[model samples]
Target: MNIAQSYEKPRWSADLCSCGDTGTCCITCLLPCITFGQIAEVVDEGGSSCVLHGCIYGALMVIQCHCLYSCLYRGKLRAKYRLPSEPCNDYCIHCCCEPCALCQEHAELKNRGLDPSKGWIGPPNAPPPMPPSMIK
Candidate 1:
C-alpha cells in the first residue's frame, strides 16, 4: 500500500505533563537522552540505533542546543503520522519546553500502539499475521 494513502490525521495522545506517567516523567527528567533516543529510533523506523542517537543527543547537549536536534525528529514524526503542527511550530515548542515536547512525543508513540522502548512497529503497510490455525 502507498504510505501516503495510509496516513491518518494527526492528533496528540496526551497533554504535556510529566504527571501523566510518573515513570516516563522521571526517566525523561533525569535522562532525556534515553527518551529522545528511543523516540528517534522509532521515528527513524529503526534505521538508526538508539544508542547512537542517544549519544548524539548527549553530545549535542554539551556543545549546542539538543532541542534543535530533537525538534527535527518531531517534524519527521509529524510528517509520518500526518499530525498537525498545533500549539506552535516544532522548533518553538521544543525550544521553549524541551521536556514537555519530548514527553508529548513519547506519549503519542505509545498511544499509537508503538512502544518506543521496543523500537519500530514495522512497516505501516505490512499485513497482519495470520492466525496459527489459518496458516498452512
Candidate 2:
C-alpha cells in the first residue's frame, strides 16, 4: 500500500469549543473576514492576498452563503494535512458555527507552526511542511 493511504492523520490540535486563543476567537466571532483571509493566504501559499479573500468572504456573508466559500478552504486545509472531518462535515461546521470553525482552523495552522497572522511567510527555500507521521 502507498504511504499516503496508510498514514494516520493527526487529530486537530485544538477543539472546536475548547478555543484556547481568545484573541483569535474574538476576531473570528466579530471579524471572520480577517481570520479567513489570513487562512486563505497561507493555504494558497500566498497565491492570493488575505485582503482579497477576506473581502470575498465578507461579500458572501451578504448573501448568507459565506459558509459555501469558507468550507471549500476548510477542505483544502484538510487535504493538505490529511485531517479528518471531525464532530461533523466542513460545510455543516461552517454553516452551524462559522466562528468556531474559523477559530479551529486558525488554531490548526498555529499548532503546525504556520502562524496565519504572519501572512504567508513560506520562504522559497524553507523546508516543506511535514505531514503527521510515525518516526519509524
Candidate 3:
C-alpha cells in the first residue's frame, strides 16, 4: 500500500463552538492577536517568533485587513497538518469568522499534542535527550 494511503484522513479535533476549551475561547474572543500569535508560533514550529507574529497581526489589524494575513496562517496550518479544507476555504472562513478560525486552529494544535500557550513542541520524530546531569 502507498504510504499516504496508510494514513487516515485528517479531521478537526473540536467543533468551532464545541471546542470545550473555554479559556482559549475567551482569549481568542478578547485578544485575537495574542491567540493568533501563539497558534502561529506553534504551527511554524518556532521558526517564527510568537511576539513578532502577534505584533504584525496587531499592526495589520490596525492599518489594514488582518484577516488576509491570518488566513495565510490558516492555510499553512492546514497544509502542515494535512487537515481537510472543510466548512469552507481558508480565506472565506477567516473573513467570515475570524475568532472562530483562531479558536479552531488553537484547538487543532492542542489536540495534536502541542500547546500554543507553551510554545513549539519541536520535531515529532526527534530523539529524546538525556537528563541535565547526563549532558556535558
| Candidate 1 structure quality by residue, lDDT tens digits, 37-96 | 999999998799889999999999998689889999999999988888978999998888
Better of 2 and 3 by lDDT: 2
Predictions: Cα RMSD each: 6.0, 8.3, 3.3
lDDT of 2 at 35: 98
Candidate ordering by TM-score (highest first): 2, 3, 1
Q: Please give the TM-score that candidate 3 achieves against the real structure.
A: 0.84
Q: Could you tell me the TM-score of candidate 2?
A: 0.84
- Candidate 2, overall lDDT? 0.90
Choose 1 or 3, whichever is better by TM-score: 3
lDDT of model 1 at residue 94?
89
- Candidate 1 minimal-lDDT segment of 10 residues: 10-19
What residue runs in model 1 are displaced by over 4 Å at the alpha carbon? 1-9, 121-136
The weakest ten consecutive residues by lDDT in model 3 span 121-130
